[model samples]
Target: MKRVQDWLLRFRWQKLLLVWGVFLLIAAVLFAERSGVQYTHTRFRLSYLPQEQAISKAQALQEQPATCLLLCDTRQSGVDNARELFTQLLQDMKVAADVVDLAEVSVNDLPAPENYQTAVVLMPNVEPLGEELLRLMNWVEDGGGLLFGMSPSNDRYFTVVSAKLGVLSTSGEYKQAESIVPAEGFMLGGGQRYELSDPFDSSLAVALREDTEVYAATGDEKVPLIWGRRQGRGRIVVDNIGIYDKVMRGFYAASYSLLQDAVAYPVINSAVFYLDDFPSPVPGGDGTYIRRDYGLSISDFYSQVWWPDLTQLAERYGIHYTGVMIENYEDDTLSAPERQTDTEQFRYFGGLLLRQGGEIGYHGYNHQPLCLPDTDYGDAYAYNQWPNADAITAAMDELIAFQKAVLPYAVGSVYVPPSNILSAAGREILGTRVPGIRTIASTYFEDGSGLPYVQEFDVAPDGIVEQPRIVSGGMVGDSYMRLAAVSELNMHYVSTHFMHPDDLLDEDRGAAEGWEVYKGGLVDYLNWLEKAAPHLRKQTGTECSGAVERFAALTVTTTGTNDAWELTLGNFHDEAWLLFRANDGVPGTVTGGQLTLLTGNLYLLKAEQPTVQILRQEG
Candidate 1:
């Protein structure tokens, strides 16, 4: 027994030593990896996409060569380094772009011949005079694009710029050379090796820290990373930190391309100037045609109007009708059972509609605008106005709860504001606060932008939604209702609405001739849509909003080292069926619907109808 005990003790010591030795080995390996001890230079792998792809994409929309003036107030080595980097990037773009160092350019020659499209002012530690800066602001607002880079220490300068540009500045110092991912249709190059680290100390990683208040006119309170506000006819892009440092250090691998894209986005978006009625032969797929379904909103049982003729007509026309049930309405108040009756009626009517392939969306808690005060005739203006965030939030909570109660399983991700009076702040609060609530409609009606007429506005930058507008009243005469049908067709989803048949009948009885024209226009539009449905890619409103959000989260950039280039792809599409065409014009197969790289020159092909191929030669 004594001898066995001795051996066991000996074994335990040996095991401890072995375990410690293994731990040490792992730590050593980790340290070596972190230190890049065993790292070696690798050959760069270029994509197979032909250079022609670039030319093709640029051919039709060729941008004129623009000169950029870089104004530097600092004589530091960092500024010199940044200038060199800018020079190199300009060469890489292969365009006739020039960057003039302001220090070298005589100040007496302040205004270059109006040909210089952009002026980048770099203020390291000094703040320019407010009046001089105002003049520069005026220049940019008039037409010239301006880029401003500031350091954390230059708070006064930052404040001046932010005040003028309607942006916020972070107080904390930024790390040099941070890698930023692009959002959409942008690509990044250079393998991990070429990835940017803090330029000050190549060993340190680049990072942008935010701990500052965003400055906007007192009433406009939205936080934006990069805010573009129309200053006169042109625009200004404001960066809180020293962009020159990032660009020079390779932190911004695709800064050059991104700058170009930024300048072009507004232009392209503006080119779509006119709003026309929805297009025919809708851009994408097909579906069956059923009679228009009117959503009869019933706040309570007593308010329910059961017209046998209407039900019969629905059946005859094979209409898959939907209905919204709110808790209460302006005139009719119901008892508990009556309210329950509303839900029960909805279930029965909903099931009937479902049998005919219809759907249902939530209305509101009391058949009124969620946050607006209640009035006698469902008029928001007459009700107590919603003036703050608390009221809006409470109203939203009530609406959501009511929705969950009435149709627990039947409800999908859709909400129709009672009068489209929802505020931008209210919508943002709801979207950010609620889960599973996908889409919300708003009241803005002007088609100032030629986009779809959907009432919702994306409070968050990059958010988008389908705007549903009332098109017609009846199916009899020449009231041609038009929408941006082609744009909506390309979208993954759509949302539209109609009231009850009684509402239509009332309108018709009051003004038969006008109603007839409205109805005829409605019928014509529906028929046209049905014929064109085959090309439309239909998705629910929730799906569409989610898609836009996901696309917004993506990062796109380009980076290149001496030997090779690498492009880092971001979540541009929730599920994009990407098409890659080789230099030879042959479509190559994509893996899991994603194309990582083209061994030779390759052009990216556009997809239509989720499956159809639309090819364009590379720029």
Candidate 2:
């Protein structure tokens, strides 16, 4: 028995050592496989659309008999602003609404109400119209659509038409609406409050009738922001919210949609997602969040935990991320930067991104903004400016060279500025020096500090397309979601969202909430966005630029009768997308296009030809 025990003890250590070595080998194999140890060189290219030499601007209000008339009084401040707002809105919607300047005509020259199916009155007062206003009211009762395009004046003139506008009573004074609360199912991302920035007295304090449907209102008191009511056989929509800015454009567009039986317009129909500062350098963020939640360092947390979550999200939603590479986080502005030699991390992350049907974009060689020394970053961001144009160009060239050396892919066509900051000199460099870059993605709206670069979705004079990021961060706030929803309606359904790898490290971006909570907020936002716009085609940065190109080049001329509407598209490319709304009729047939039902009364149409015909049955 003593000999047996002695033999067992000696072999036990050997067996245990053998078991530990086998486990280590298995773990190493898994780590290699999961981390993409074997990098695959991928050739990436921008999917630019066929360009047209010259695209004509769509002429607003053709000589053909108009279907809608807009009464604009250039004398009144509200009317002037409303005209500017509605003119662009109608032009985008392809609605043949003729503008009739009240200053150019007398009360006797007012057109008969029977001449148009719908009318928008932008005048603060109707005293100049005299008895002619009664003719329009009678026309509304006899099956015409009317929209009070601006907040009505508090006078006897508006009081007389108040009944037709669904106003049961009014305090006759303007009220300050603190927040915009859209009703459930009223807009894309409804059932939420979008707080106003320093709200003013822009809406009237009016009580609506019981039967009047309120689409939007003030958050606290529920004062009608936008409401609609039926008078006899006609419908009337009142846009009580008087604020007019770029942000309010979509809200007003939606309110105008309620004035018609049907409305159809072209949309970009693309959604792009961007990852800033990805696959470049490991961000130095506070490790408390990672340590507390995952017991891992920030660097290890990104590889093992954060990246896995993002990749899983992409897989679940079939999202293709455009990762903008930042070669290093060093602020090396004066010197000509050398090509980065440590290519393992870049290869690993870039390879993983490409394998998932993603694309790489140019951010910067370093974390510095591309502004000249004269430019100031202000208090919001502390970024060093470039010494001169030569320095900026040298850094950019080094960035391009490093990207080329690491990956077999062509230089990316999209360039996103660091911290969304770029100066006139920097832009000139990109336009002239960086010939491969075709698009610049920056912030859409200003953050008021004048630090972030602000842009509109349009082709710049230098021929570079501007595809601005509309929303950002994992903790998508109410205001950001509101902007997303509004842009979807006005910008023809294009959404640009950007995020960063180091968002987990910053407390301002909800890092202290831990990965689960931080990631949950992003997931919830994605879920809401998916539910709101399932039809939005997921595109990468270059693909989105391609979509913007097509949308910009095409001009739509709408002509229709009572039962049919024909759209003739100019500069028609290989394909075109449009949003057609059937408000008063059922779509009977669509020719020269394929129709996909998106939601109630909305159909996404893919036009194959320049001329698309739509036939509808009377509702």
Candidate 3:
């Protein structure tokens, strides 16, 4: 019995030691987590804007249906704070928002399609479901908006989401002082003091004070916290502060205000949905050529009746012309002799055009829409035939070969669809399949694609001048004159073409008594433009093409919503100064080299070679 007792005592002692080791291991893990965590101190209150007033103002706005999706892991304390804050925000803005717990719903069980127009996702400590979150980002890209908040513990997920949304989040921890006092220049509510003890820093705290500011600070090093970006038709507000701290919870007033503002801003601003690329000179001077349809089919009057007179008039007015060659088929049947004769005439005309400092771009193989399936061409002779991919390829090959044969004098060879009627497949063939063809005329799709907002501009039937297509041509007149002369203007670096010289010549004659009057008017307009808008620079189709290619190659550094932006124009040249307006204000100069801008409205910038660096400004 004594031996049994001794063995039992030894087992108890061993069990006690094991428990102590387990306790130490847990303690170590907790200590590591605490040490690595970031903390934010909320000691500063906005000097010019009080939290209550901001919230009150936001609440007074007409309410809209919006949801704040809180995706928190119930097991983490960080998520608990997020839940509490979300609950309070909903309670405060009951009319404007609803807080939805994503954890409660299955992936397939998202709210009905139209129940909400916006969402704020709180991903505090949970491991981000990468692919799933990526899919959700698609909603914002499609016009639905989102707001994201995360902690340093989830840096991997934060980075993935940031990249997809065109933003970047830092890796280290940041801290706000234990308390803060407003500075003299503070724009928000008058001098006020506050206390803070949150684990994560509120890097975006300054943004909450006004509609027009962005504030950020890096980790403990205090590398001026910079963390805010506009993302795909929506705004994303990021704070490095820990989600679980009481100090952060105390700022619920400001946080809720921000949430309310994000939801309401889009509705109140009509211009948010209307964005466009500022018109600037095409990067290179090569985009100035013209596109024309019809080679030899036009009656000999083209040269004998129109060329001599038009050439003389253009020379007198210091204007040049570039003729685009098109195969005009009055009837499908043409004897070999007639075909050869017509081809020769085209070559002769092309030579004349080049000698006169003009260019000749392709106007489709036979002045037809190049679509797949010959059956789709129907009975219209103008439709020609693009039976299949092979047929289209063959046609383009023949046309290019013919043009090359006429070489040396062809001078700047490019192709322009007869009536802007090429299919996607045709575009692919021109852009990729065809080799040695340096450039393709800008198409409608190129101009309108991916614009943040809907806008109306002039569009010509042929891919020529980018003009506003007002219904009444007589209202603006046939010259395509602009209505208002603002300091800034958007000029598309595109080649413009007009039909047979006879049409333009006739219009000129009808508008004036003779060629001299026409010449005088043209010269006067050019002179006035140069004097009034000396920055206007001419670009050729090739230059425009190169610029576009370069633009395509650039990597987008950031993205976000909010119409206001601050862009950096680095190392620009004297000749490349661009004109722009801030926040829809009057036009201002955008000198090249290093420049900064802040504005809400869209403006035009003119430059020969310009690089754009964008930052979102809250106001």
Q: TM per model?
A: 0.38, 0.83, 0.37
RMSD, one per candidate, in order:
26.6, 6.6, 33.3
lDDT of each: 0.36, 0.77, 0.37
The regions of model 3 sitting more than 4 angstroms off are 1-300, 312-320, 327-344, 374-382, 409-413, 442-497, 502-534, 550-578, 582-619
Off by over 4 Å in 1: 1-325, 331-341, 354-359, 372-406, 424-436, 447-483, 486-502, 505-520, 530-533, 554-569, 572-574, 577-619
In angstroms, the error of model 3 at 47 is 54
lDDT of 2: 0.77
Candidate order, TM-score descending: 2, 1, 3
Off by over 4 Å in 2: 1-46, 53-146, 181-186, 191-197, 209-213, 229-236, 486-491, 617-619
**Please, what are the lDDT tens digits per residue for candidate 2 over residues 22-48?**
999999976755555444443333356
* Candidate 1 per-residue C-alpha lDDT over 1-619 given as tens digits, one digit per residue, 9 for 90 to 100: 9998788687857778778999999999765433323422211111111212212212211343445665664454356755554443333222234454445654555555246665655555335333556677777767665654433243465556664554443434334323332222222121111122233311111122243222111111222223334456445544433444311322222222222212111000000000111000111111111111223322221123333333453454333343443444432222121223334434444444333333344555444343423222232244334545565555556655654554444444445565444544546665666543454533224333322223422213212243343332343122212222212221211223343333333433222343234444544544554443322223333333343333223222223233322233332332322212121232334223333332223222222222322232233
